[model samples]
Target: MKTMVQIVDYAERGQSLYIQLAVTDGETEKRISGEVRFLGELLYGELVHDKKSPLSEQARMDTIAYLKAHFGR
Candidate 1:
């Protein structure tokens, strides 16, 4: 399946950055909300998926790659 990811919202709250994403794979569309927490020079993202829509692993990986490229990280 061809996956597509769109960033719906991005915001910085304190030491963490929050991102809202829309992920689609032609057949299904899901919402993924993530928080990127900064720890010194390192950062990690925790993603929450929409149970109703359900997300594929490929779609999730694509979303993460999109976010990395979007931030130029």
Candidate 2:
């Protein structure tokens, strides 16, 4: 599925960032807002778990890929 990702907010947190993202795949949409901490060249974080974000594991990974493409180390 083709997905779209947009950065809604970017908050600085020392060496990391707390980001708010809007992720969509035409029909379904989700809000992925969380803090991302990088270790060396790797980024680790989780998507916000709530009723509004009924996304599958694959969807969440895709969203992360998009986020990384835009704002990764």
Candidate 3:
């Protein structure tokens, strides 16, 4: 068995962080996935979790306000 994985790139935008990664097992295969992460809000960033939660109008507005104030960007 082999193992190797590392973050190739990342970008920060307010309350969101976009991440790119390169993963390999030192064999003959590679995998990749992209995702957005919200600070202090795991469910808000997760695909499965977010879908279960409520992304209501109020929730979106609140998130905007939070990101603007916390990240100042």
Better of 1 and 3 by TM-score: 1
Models ranked on TM-score: 2, 1, 3
Q: Write the per-residue lDDT of candidate 1 for residues 1-73, one digit (tens) a residue.
A: 4777777777776655666666665446544444444333344554423333355666656665667667655
- lDDT, each prediction: 0.57, 0.59, 0.42
* Candidate 3 lDDT, 9-57, residue by residue in tens: 7677776665453433333343423333555443233311435423333
lDDT, candidate 3, at 30:
38
C-alpha TM-score for every candidate: 0.56, 0.57, 0.36
Candidate 3 has which clashing residue pairs, if any? none
In candidate 2, what are the lDDT values of residues 14-71, reduced to their tens digit?
A: 7766666666643455444444444445665555333334556566667767766677
- For candidate 3, the lDDT comes to 0.42
- At residue 39, candidate 1 shows an lDDT of 35
CA shift of 35, model 3, Å: 5.5
The worst-scoring run of ten residues by lDDT in candidate 3 lies at 41-50
lDDT of 1 at 29: 56
